[model samples]
Target chain A: MDFAEICEEKFDINRYLGLLCHPGCGGTSVFMGTSRCTSKISDKTVKALDYTAYVPMAVKKLKDVCVNARRTCAVGNIVVAHRVGYVPVGEPGLFVGVSAPHRQAAIQCMDLTITAIKAGVPVWKEEVYEDDTRAWTTNAECFWLPKPPTHSTDLPQK
Target chain B: MDFAEICEEKFDINRYLGLLCHPGCGGTSVFMGTSRCTSKISDKTVKALDYTAYVPMAVKKLKDVCVNARRTCAVGNIVVAHRVGYVPVGEPGLFVGVSAPHRQAAIQCMDLTITAIKAGVPVWKEEVYEDDTRAWTTNAECFWLPKPPTHSTDLPQK
Candidate 1:
């Protein structure tokens, strides 16, 4: 599922949940992105924030991730939603859900889905500080690097 | 979130969504395992199956995956659930959810979570065929092999 809407309303976990469920699926994975109260540059505590997306492109990217995941993994249903406009601290900025037939596939698909969103989607956010300061931030560095294997003996036993 | 109960209920998508909703996270990964109607042995269509688990041990293993995921990755929540008793063809067999601050971490944790479940959980399944034939199956062979790198210059991504 791909949704692009300007929501100033409260983040609805139930709505996110509803979109992620599929009877045919046995596993579901999700990710939620929230605003941090502290800024890395000024170290100012943030009170609120505003998020915006290049709606058409963002939606296309979201759809692309879902489609790619479905093709790559044994996944069933998927949902991705991002909150636009003003959001308060502790509020979710983005949400992604993936459902599949097996737990492992679901987890793997979810990882790929979220990664695709971050690397490809054109979404931007502005931090609104408690002192009425605000600045736009780009998601250019939101890349994920895979972890090194912990043990050589932990290799896949196929 | 932790749950302990038994009911004749359909799958719950919200719980899975909850697993993904972590504010510090940029990605969420998941895996789902389903019941296939075809058997690997005879390639015959399956009818139903009975699942049994050493409840306490299974729960312990599930919790262990969650704990390990949190420690190893910047994940928000991890969820794993398996069905017991009988399940029909095309039905859901298990659920696993993981949420992390980054897509790579989420994917890594989810992969490990599912792998641990298969290796350590005491859950078992007995397949029932249309001809009243029955046989037990283990998930040992379901372990996946990492795909070879697509390009000579490409380093391993997952």
Candidate 2:
């Protein structure tokens, strides 16, 4: 069985693990999208993030990801969740969990599923910066964006 | 900061997430190696698994993985844990969590770190099967091992 949906509640890791676990599976892979206090836009310090989604389409694509992974790999179970509304820095806004009876299947399917999510999922994010500067991003653009330039004065060093 | 260590206690997912969470991080990738009731060895079914390690060397290599990841990627924090001792089916035996300022770094570093662990880490496992059959293996051998062909009687059908 698999689960894919968008919710506004804070994620419970253990709960997701419970949903993903299968006695026949040997490996589980998880990817989380967490809000950052720093942004790749340079000179910006993020305080939180706001997430929105076209619920019907987003949910449909998320399920399609699971279905596609299963069609191509020996996936056991999956749980894909994307949170809507406010997400503070250091908090997760998205989670993908998958399992397979073998390591390669779990790893391969997970990588494939996450890539699919980033490429086509309808989820969008608006970075709420410390300086009140804000920017919106699609799931795809965030990964390909330039790295945030580092400075000597960036707070909470390392 | 980064963490890598072997433990005998069951993993608490929240604790690991706490260790990996950093305000500067926008993405976190997690991979869990769960104990399976099924094994690649045909005609056998796993009941649990027993793990062991050469602590000094294992810990050293684990730390090296983190250092290597940091050297190559803009990783914010990492937490790698491999549990020793008995692990029942559906329980996690290993976890690798990483976060970065951007999604690519987190994803790339996570993929790299896991591959490194499977390729050379000193951890070992002995599969305890339900039919009284047992087999020992190294971390490297597990992933490359031949997949067990599926049969109609596979229990707990997905």
The candidates' DockQ values read 0.20, 0.68
Clash number for candidate 1: 24
Tell me the tens digit of each residue's lDDT in model 1 across B51-142: 87767777876787677667767766677777788777655566666665555776677678777777766677777677766777646544
Instruction: Give Cα distance to truth, residue B153, candidate 2, Å.
Output: 26
lDDT at position B89, candidate 1: 65
The candidate 1 chain B region of ten consecutive residues with least summed lDDT is B147-156
lDDT of 1 by residue, A4-111 (tens): 333456667667655665654555666666665656545667776687666777777777777777788876677877777898765677777676656667666766
Q: lDDT score, residue B136, model 1? A: 71
- Clash pairs (backbone) in predicted model 2: none
Q: Please, what is the whole-model Cα lDDT of each candidate in the order they appear?
A: 0.63, 0.81
Alpha carbon lDDT at B127, candidate 1:
73
Candidate 1: residue A91 Cα off by (Å) = 4.5
Where model 1 places Cα greater than 4 Å from the true spot, the runs are A1-29, A36-42, A46-49, A64-78, A88-91, A98-109, A130-132, A141-158, B1-28, B36-49, B87-93, B128-134, B141-158
Per residue, candidate 2 scores C-alpha lDDT tens digits across B58-111 of 889899989988899998898999988999899998899998887778878888
Interface RMSD of each: 4.5, 0.9
